[model samples]
Target: MKKSRLILSLLLAFASTLASAQSENPPPVKEDFKPSVLNQPGKEYPQVNSQGYVRFRIEAPDAQKVHVSLGLGGRGGTALTKGADGIWEGTTEGPLDEGFHYYHLNVDGGTFNDPGTLNFYGSVRWESGIEIPAADQDIYALKDVPHGKVEQILFPSKSTQTSRRAFVYTPPGYGKDRSKKYPVLYLQHGWGEDETAWSNQGHANLIMDNLIAAGKTQPFLIVMTYGMTNEVKFGQLSSFDITPFQTVLLDELIPYVDANYLTQADPAHRAMAGLSMGGMETRTITLANPGVFSYVGLLSGGSISMEDLEKSPDFKKNVKLLFVSYGSRELDNPRRGPWGDPKENTAAVTAAGLKTHFYVSPNTAHEFQSWRRSLYVMAPMLFK
Candidate 1:
């Protein structure tokens, strides 16, 4: 009887331990092993093929209706066929443009994502689907044209701490001849844009290449650099540091170009110009560092006043030709007109005994079209 009692007590203790361990740590669940999509798949997303039309599959267990929204003017609701596997799928017509498009999957009572496609974008903060080599492919990238060499060069700036790299565009005839000297153009991009903005979005390289090939403009080096400091973004000029960038341009970029290529170091052969914030930077640099640049161009410049010109001692003496161009559309309401106008300020500078030329293009407002036209008009005046 004593042995039986001891055995029974041991069995009871073992059962209790097993029960406690089971309660603390259960077996591995297959639901936990499933991916995020399988766990809560609801919205169906559209997929883009090489031809461009979007198609996709959606799996909504409790959905009554399903539809997909397309681009700019795309709208429709097509019933999806419920498969034996409980997945609904449908295809849209073909050949969509190769750009970004937003879409959402609408189900019966709610909407969800497409579990079939990995590509997705946010709604309020929705993701987008990107198509390449479809309807709206890049024209230049597809063209069989010879592209000039572009390089990102980092140097010290008098304006910033770690300095930045500027994009330098050397024409086709850059290094073939040893004794050829090229004029230099210091082109600037607008706010939130870096040196690559002109070459990338502005198509400046194409413009220059065509001009040089046709003998319209002389072969020259284009130096595109960042014009604003970090402090400019925050609306605080007191914290801005530009001495380093200025030092880099004068000390590093210029010397390097003058040594590597046949360049005229004199101010008469160099031109400085920019758009928006870059315009302000050009104005400031040209006025402060007199005799460093002969020609200065401003496109849709913002918040410039007579005070800025009157305060600068070098404004009248050093500047040879000041080209002030603004879009006629922007001189009116909103966007950029209310603070201070470029046309009014240019007139003020002209009245202050500075040589200035003003032109306004029609139907534009601080856009790439305005800047492109500005460059087309300004390049001829450079190194003249």
Candidate 2:
């Protein structure tokens, strides 16, 4: 009886100590939420808390079912409960990854956008977008700096037989020196996104503006065009052909850009980069035309292999930089993509006497935030 009493006393003391520890390090309390920056003027329903939980409100009284298509789970997973006031509202079960996310409302079996937030083009259509403030958002934050102009140019593409549009970003001192020819980076958007993505979604212009002001990156020109990815559905990726878009970019767009803009007009100063499917396009086109681009970047897209270097000797010889980056969450996933291990592949490329860099974004997935961070890390290394 004495021994049993002693054991019971020890157990109770242990429980008390554990409770004290928990009280000292209590679980995070839900922070007060504010209207998301992406919300429409005076809209207060689509809000985000400091913990990254998204709260959505919809005034659909007659809707039988309503759900949000974003958050930890997939589409139609976040079921909104109808309140007594006839307003359908819900909060994400957990925190979302930092950056922008596109979501839509499914009400009464019909897909619709949340009227509270602004729309962004994704999945080949306009969907409501929200911004979850990031810890390291200062890198892309709008500052009092010399901003560059993102000019839209429509260049004729005879292969497609239409006037294809492209957005160009000329650095701050571009017009000041008429004779100065800036190096060009032919940047491409991911699948389902068009030319405006780099500007609107990724804030490529603002990124460059801040980088230039801080002297963190080289002032250069950036060109973004539609990668013709909308025609290819997600399941039918294998059926996508590169010949047409390659022809349009190489034969038409390059010539037009050189003729119109004060570009360096040499292979040593030109580069190509893309995100996701756009990265796949960059790899194909860069391999096919070795002399066109000296630097290459792939953001959440893919990586270059030893086999690739063996086949394209000229690219291996002349390429100035081969940069590959993916979000850390993607690398931690079970799906390591088609190239096997991107990190190991990049290490192999580095071992083969070529300048190579592999960057993994912290706490992000395959989103614009990853691509934006990739551009920031890779831009300073270009044309040097």
Candidate 3:
């Protein structure tokens, strides 16, 4: 009996130890971490269409307050309610019109991104963003229309051995009609942005896509490249050093694109366009290599001088169109660089006998909206 009791006690002790070990080492968690969500299954924001308030709902259990800031020229309003389930709701008076507006959310002044929507940052930071398909009439403001293709391709830069990536957009029917070559527009992005700036922030692709579909604009290939030569950033350095960038485009980017795509490589079929520093680069390229690009569109940029025109002996005979554009609101802001002052350069280019189109957008500022409008107006002028 004693032996049997001792055996039973030993078994009980072993069982207790095993139970404790198993309790300490539990199974791994199954659900991985994910971004916070406002609307779960069966929960959603009110169905507001393209002309109503901009609505946002977020679930932040501990957040005491939530608010959104309206971008461009006005202050933002506060949210309407906080639900029992830790969800907060807000609305604004405008679904801003057909132009691009950037915004952000301030959770008691601590910033947070919208969980439900695709975010877009401008030529600068991504933290600043706005909601699209948010009560707006503009189709390009995030409608689900058939879109054009913007490809990111790397090409050799004579300025440096490290390959540079450029953004290219082929119009809707670029592949379908193989026999007919399309006119090419070599576009450049401003400093601090890659080739994606024109398409994403500037909405160049959508503008071209819409224009081509409507037959309002000629179908052309847009080749947007990095504007900096060997410099890491474009505007961080002065425009005087951009000659090497011009060389890279001329010696490498232009030739590679022409060879790979179905493009009419002739000067008459070639053009250049850019914003800010990009605009400056465009002017430099056309002036240095006269007869290379027939048409030039300068949007919110281009720091050309009378001397530049005089230096280019063939500036008059080779060039076809010189379109210089700037926002009326940007004239006061020196941050727009040298292109804001178009009078002297305009007179110089006109005196050189090139057809000059000086365009000014009243009340528009040195922002992407101004550039987008500039592109829309200037695209129709190409290959005509």
Candidate 4:
């Protein structure tokens, strides 16, 4: 009885100490977590806190391991801990970048999509996605003011031997005035993404609608198409040829768009812009066919130099606006172009009597947020 009493006293004292420690320092996680906005219709598993940390609850009862492919920096994603209830749950080590991010799940050495979230086309496949709400997300939000329609058209492409599909965004009042002709901006997505990226992921239509409704930009037609003409796989970009895509854009899509839509149909009223590898396409195509585009814009793409101008002498004379942009984070270890720093190249081009503009998005990397912000800034300066 004496031994029993002594053990009971020790147990009670240890419990009391643990209780005191927990009460004195609560868990660091905030309690105000909500389901991700990108979650599927009624499913709720992935949640985000005020600090942008993402919490994932996955159901894989028999799997030996489960991992989330989204984490801060180079942590190699989040590893979930299984509970007695057989649910795998974990939180990211740090907050993720704001905006839509494509991620996948690793289940027992195989890849799978999170059943709770919607899938988006990225990384050359349809992968699960989550959106960390941005402070400026209102810019792409659906507003009651006015809205544009994203029309899909199949244009004949003789070069590719198949009918190509493209989405065209006509401004709010586009159909109302049948006689009004608007300028056109041809937009391209990144390497892995296709034509739908601008519409689905980037919200190109909403960006243009908000800008037009707010009177910040002139209403125009925005066209988005697939940039990969040769089906080049990853790590094969060096062998990628731009001629096929260029032919489809200039010889096929542009003519089809002009004939089908109410466009100005002249080089002065046409602008071309792209992101990432799409930017490389913009640089190659724009320089190769200088007379075809009046306004050139590249987002996180390559830069133009004096040598390029010398190669295409008509570029300075015919081009109305030259816009270049990159996320500030991308310049951390600035990739030197053939000429020099991209910013310095823009400055040199500007000093040489050509209309040049450069913009760097703050606190973003080579993600869609940077490209979205680039379009926002370049829209107003086009066709001026």
TM-score of each: 0.59, 0.90, 0.68, 0.90
Candidates in order have lDDT scores of 0.58, 0.81, 0.63, 0.81
Candidate 3, TM-score vs. the true structure? 0.68
TM-score of 2: 0.90
Candidate 3 lDDT by residue in tens digits, 3-84: 3233223322221210011122333333332221212335344223344234567777688777766421333344546888
Window of ten residues with lowest summed lDDT in model 3: 14-23
> Candidate 2 lDDT, tens digit per residue, 1-384?
343233223322221210011112323539699999999999997999988878989999988999888756333346799999999988876777788777799988898999999888776778888888998788789888888899999999888778988999998878787798999999988766788888888989998999899998889999999887336664544456777788888999999999999899999999999987678779878977888999999887778889888888888888999999988877766667566688988899899988998999888777888888999899999999
The Cα RMSD in angstroms, rounded to one decimal, for candidate 2 relative to the true structure is: 12.6
Model 1: per-residue lDDT, tens digit, 23-113? 2232332221112221224433444444444455677655666765542222343456677777776654333333233345667745665
Pairwise TM-score winner, candidates 2 and 3:
2
lDDT (0-100) at residue 287 of candidate 3? Answer: 77
| Predictions: Cα RMSD each | 21.6, 12.6, 20.7, 14.5
